[model samples]
Target: MRSPNPRILYTALCLTGLSLATSVIAQDSNEEVSRIEQVIVSASREPETGLNLTLPWSRIDDDALKLTGAVHINQVMQRAPGAWISRGNGQESLVALRSPVLTGSGGCGAFYTAWDGISLRAPGFCNVNQLFDVNSEQAGAIEVIRGPGTAVYGANAVHGVINTLTADPRQGPEHGYAVEAGPNDYYRVRGEFRAEHGAHAVGVHFNGVSDGGYKDNAGFDQQKLTLRHDFSGEQWQVTNALEATNLNQETSGFIRGFEAYKDPNLKKVNPNPEAYRDSFALRAYSRWSRETGAGQLSITPYFRRTSMEFLQHFLPWQATEKNGQESLGLRLALSDSIESFSWSTGVDIDATRGWLREVQDDDFSPNQPAGVHYDYEVDALSAALYGQANWQLTSRLGLAAGLRLEQNSYDYDNQTDDGSACAPEASACRFFRPADREDDFSNGSINLGVTYALSDDHRIYLRGAQGFRPPQAAELYRLQSGQEVADLDSETITSVDLGLRGAMGGFSYDASVYSMQKSDVIFQDADRQNVSGAKTRHVGIEFSVYWTGESGWYAGIDGNIARHRYDSDANLLGSRLDIEGNDIDTAPRHFGSARLGRDTALKSGRSLTTELGWVHMGSYYLEPDNQHEYEGHELLNLRLALALGKGFSTTVRVSNLLDEDYAERADFGFGAYRYFVGQPRGVFLEFAYSPE
Candidate 1:
């Protein structure tokens, strides 16, 4: 499980043999090599053409999201391929796709996040740093589907799915603005607008940031907003969206011993300086499609609200929570075609009302109680019905299938006075409360696929899937110590994938290999009850590549090489040693990112671009009886842009560029070892304006 970094696997096998030898020398140079298809929309939710998608997809376009003006969101979701995201401190984060980076409370219900395709928190409430509540810094695209996207995304999509696409106003009039600055006292501002009139279109995007801490009193301030509207006639078409987010943080905990993120003054020490976090979110949606006759029909309606308060300060009795939620939803879809077979069907409905509160002002011991150790309220309902089909069995083969049926219910409602919050024999308390309850979960998902086509720029595929989630609501009413009713079950994953994808001349690639198995899997044992089967296994190889050589140069890579073990053998955390095939804590057998760029035009007309980036992290095992490890890190980044034509522009960025002392996350509980260090060598600058 530890091998990788043979000089980045020999530069990823010499850039996969130089993109298969320049795509067979540009198909024998008789010229003509422009294919360009690539289109995606969260698979099966509409737009398609990810080379006849049968699964494993990736996208992160929009000019790499404005040259990755990202300050987080793990810098554009690690450029896709088997994602990782990690990064904590400030805007916090944790997500691993194709599994493992998962943490408790249902481990964020096993991956599924969305903005344009809704679901940003509903299905039983999830939030492992809820992707900082959307706006993906004004996303234009960010699709990813690594594995098991729950038979077309229903209930948590088990091990993958991420959408976030917005910004489309008939692609017309536009306006932009930017300002940025970096290092500790950072600053940022961004804005965007789009317009169109004839059939109405409008868009707006926003951003805001303020940072100051590197550690000693961590800092953060954030904001995001999005609004969009579009309407087209001649047969109904409407789209509307609204998004908002806010965050105020000053949280930092973790900086313990062992390797202390390579020291440097304990990596900027910040021992929970009065930890904090505050959050807010809002969402709205409307999408209606047209052309119907039992065929192309779509409808969407949504709303969401969120609120949060933090300072759990990594526990040991530092409680202080507060949560919120309010939601309403609807989605319906139908598509049709017969002869060669094509089909689509959908239905989803959601409802939520949530609340939580925890408190502890002192009294850090006596079974760790202070007061109010949990007050709850929940009311969740989710429903789903899905279907998909495709067949083309000839023109080079194709076939696909899907199905989903889901239901989730939770009624909960206990505002104190359930079970242990201490006092009744103190020693057996550690905040357990669960009294009024009602839970239900019914799930199912399925998928199958096939694809052939060997020429016309490659294609080959195979897929199989199944995914599920349902057991969150704070993992069944937040219990602890004297547990109470958390006989959980729904958590599943089954997957298979094999692949090759295409595009020639200018080079493009997608590669895959997968295997997965996950079952019941819900933990907390070692007496803190709340359990479920527990099993895991995942295998992987993932890749993505791009090239655009004919002069202005470009290159890309995204990576993965995985393993996530522990299939059976448990005790949750009393560690009784012997973990089934180990390897799972912070799983990372390999990680990736790479890019190289060039563009020039100057001669007074203005244009220049330069880029270089590489990021890698491979070492793993920080627990799960694998005894502790974390020797991975690599980073370098640089960017520059210049264009001074009337619509002004400027950019410069340098992140960790060679100043590496890493650990953007690492841990090994209570017995020591922790981190979240990483972040050095900063440099940033930006200024922009647009009009053309």
Candidate 2:
């Protein structure tokens, strides 16, 4: 791998130090002092102030969500350090958190995604583009943990965790609505209603969107609905939530050639107009909690159903695949505190039934058949037991530790004739069907940390943790090149982090450095065989800082400098290559965003807010050989909002303000370069109304 870039690291460290120094100087000034403490729930599955948490995490609040008005989740996710949601054609994305943008059937298993503290999908049945199945567009808050979360979250928390919290009926206006319009014939409508009676409250939120897309024949229509009910009693509190989402999109395949995104005409062309994806998901859950003599007891049960159909345009055979899953799960927890010690313990249980089918219409070659490639069904069961505790040994020193044990089992049934799909005279087929079989995996994870308080508003912490993910169903059953069975071990990662976080005199900052090592990584070898026992290493420095002046001005910056490299010799593209120490493809060394804004109050109870944002993506190799590269790009964004008294407001946003040309993603595959052209400059306007 390439040597670490000192310039980039130095710049990020300087910014973080400046924010801390300014806080000290401002604290001594005569100006009014203000402090804010943000609350997060992803750390321990309970509301806790971020200032006191031992984890490295970030949150995007409702105010920021409203001001940004993101059509894509990537817009708001960029504000968090060490995070990158790689955007694809309309509503599709690949996630990278403290690691490279991993791709493949099992890549999505590295990160755990949830809604309202409930897992969105059952273990061993994850989809790479599953983020679109949630209603993040209208979430009350989005929280992200940058490193391993397995100790508290169980399996599939190898890289990190992201949780989207639903809007609470008691916190916002009673009735609200918004209408938005933008370039490319795009339109969206959003509405919400809340009602309270006695000790019961209900909230209904919904949104719909229609877009004419930037690339030819590439458009999408989507809808999302959420329902929340809450009941407060003397001894018990109950919260119920239901969420549903649907998406129908015409996808555009990658355009090939070097720097094709720079060509105006080529950038707008679609290579596969017939490529499309349709997906739907529904989830419901209820959480009940109360104070008890033993401890604070809580119980939660959830149900989920999801289905999807998409054309595999990236493959030469152009096969179509359909898949779905239905699951039921439950979570129970208890917590208590005595003296200077606090502790929590929990148990999780889940069961799911899933099925998949793939078919090709016409023959592409002798090795690629035209009939059904594979058809199979799987039943999965997962369970875990976990506990965590904290001890305040002294007024200034503390210690924390957690441990988890999880088991996952899968029962696979094949509905097709076993063996290769090609005829006997043909060479080994590219697709193979495995016989019916059963597989099971068990894994353990643990975390330990220590913290020391420097003063009333400052503290430092050091943490070490382990995480793991069982192989997905597809990776085991969807064999290739005559492989009869896949015997793969669970993937695991160990990470260590050192950090500091605090808030003082209207200034808040978080800075951390982390190193991680992964083992038993699953990937296809150069000879097209399923394999394991690979290894990789990751190291990075991440920071986020913000300053809000009493005069209604604020500035903030967040970013990371990191390197991801292979720790073992490997082969690539049918060639024997010594790839040890080489930088992983699509893994950028540095990327980040910065923002400057101010707010002013006008006469008649009106207000005005303006902000500008800068986003940077550093260069990285497009292939393992490190022979091809994509030079990075930067763009600017602007937003202005006007609040007209009496529950009326208007917002105008401009994306890609400088009209620069760039590619949202770049790749080298099939012996050619491919790019997903970024959208051109766009202007969006929205009008909203809410009654007081």
Candidate 3:
């Protein structure tokens, strides 16, 4: 894999300009662009607006996102309530929604990330950095379902769900293009086109970015394209979406030592400069809807193909890992209204085939082998059925209940027997890979809620739900020397939530408190063996409030304060260790952000907007033992934009304005403290054009 050179990036920008010019030639047909509005979220699996939602949620509209200057998911998610998106090396991130910044092979399966209501990867093959597959930078809206999602989403919806939607073509015919340049020789080009003719509509988007990076040999280049089409008939409609993505990343491993992020020299040096990751994905899905006697019915069918290869620089013995998967899935649902109740039912099915291979190329210890350590293939099948009903119990009271049953099965085939050994040169080994095996799990989820409307603009609700997820393929197949087989159960959580949500005049607010208990938690023991059947507890309060006055001023604050702790004792090495009531690692107790901005009208139908934002994170333990902790930091950001005309705009953004040195992520493992250094103070300029 190779990063794009300066000349290539320049050529790419020039081609984008040519495309924009070509789109302008179709102006013979005059059209008026409609104003953008906040959309009702479909991820809720119900027909409800944000103001009427009983569950804790958040939405980032196009207007607020403009002031963010967001290039990464972390930048935008920070504005949401109880959400923490941490960035690693180039385009890599981990999400935390009412949970911790989960790590390890099992981390990716704890949250569900989707594009247009479709999962990025199959259940067992989830990538931790799956967000890179979606073009969120150009999305129409980003919806977040905090805590356990609706029953219709099924597995991997434990902590929360993120769904990104593409712009609708009905708002066209419209064309948009943007060019951005910033510190570290960064450059990006983006373009979009939407048009509608009679009953058919089409939308297309393209994005590309290249950066020289701040650390040595740490650079990346990425590109993505999405195409969508919609066709409507008298009583039936069909929508199709297709996307292709490619990424080449030169990864930078963490720097070791306490407070190492403050060292300017160390922050610029890449400890593992040879690390790189290259990946590609192609996904397509179609949704069909028709009017039925009972109500409206919809069916969706999807296909996915993805492949990736990366170097394991964090491990002492560097290994080259490769994996790929192909899947076919279908979802069906129906909704109708009864006398006083609204109900919906759905079913989901999926089948996938995948393979994984790992080989050690650089051995730092003589005890570790230098040959192929793992090679396997797996076939996975999953199915689920769910139903939900909402009833108006009284003039001002409502009740909602839902139930879901799901099953997952995996068939594994091991192609190598030398996966582990008592010695690196041993003739045979018996520790890591066991004989071919089949594992299956059956789980269920339940959701119940009650709501009372105190007035037209005030409401309160109570909700209790259960969520579960089956074990991931890596947790079962990626074996260490101490174990011959992994016997794990599905992780489950039970939570109770109480909240108030509503809009009054020019003010809107959402606040909630939740208590949860998780069973069968998966983790690595002191013996360095993977196991399940542990327990944990979580409790938190999160809220968001925004006020917009007629004086053109607006302000809002959103944040979460939480505690997560282990509630079980364990057998470590050989002796029993009492770890009850210990705080969970990487889970901060307090974190949130605030923003203040204003919009002013200028001369001749123009306007100017500016925003000032602040972010704060509290200190937290870096290890399960609760002996090591990281001191968190606060940050400030500024953004200013001017509308040049009806079709053009310009913006100036400054990040880390105080130039404070900090760590984006911190951890203690392998007998040392490691950190991913955060970016320093940087200035960026942006120019955009959107014709009406």
Highest lDDT scorer: 2
For candidate 1, which ten residues in a row score worst on lDDT?
27-36
Candidate 2 local lDDT, 1-692, one digit each (tens): 23235356447645754664485546442221222256778988887666666778988888889999998998999899999999999999999999889888889999999998777888998998899999998899999998898356987898899899999988899999999999888999999999999999999999999999999999999999999999999998999999999999999989999989999879999999999999999999999999999999999999999999999998988999999999999999999989999899999999999999999999999789899998999999999999988898899998889999999999999999898988887787898999999999999999999988888678799999999999999999999888999999999999999999876676777899999999999988876777888999999999887777665777788888899998987765533467889888889999888888889999999999999987878888888777788887887899999999899999999999989888999998878889999999999999999985
Model 1 alpha-carbon miss at residue 574, Å: 35
| Positional deviation of residue 650's Cα in model 3 after best superposition, in angstroms | 0.8
Task: Write the residue-wise lDDT of candidate 1 on 190-298 in tens digits.
Answer: 8888888799988898889999878888988898989899999999999988989999999998889987877787888898899999999999989989987789899
TM-score to native of every candidate shown: 0.34, 0.96, 0.92
Alpha-carbon RMSD to native, per candidate:
23.7, 2.8, 9.3
What 10-residue stretch in candidate 2 is worst by lDDT? Answer: 27-36
TM-score winner? 2
Q: Is candidate 1 or candidate 3 better by TM-score?
A: 3
Clashes of 3: 0
lDDT-better candidate, 1 vs 2 = 2
**lDDT of model 3 at residue 93?**
87
lDDT of 2: 0.88
lDDT of 3 by residue, 439-503 (tens): 99999999998889888667799999888889999888877655778899999989899998765
Clashing residue pairs for model 1: 521-534
Candidate no. 3 TM-score: 0.92
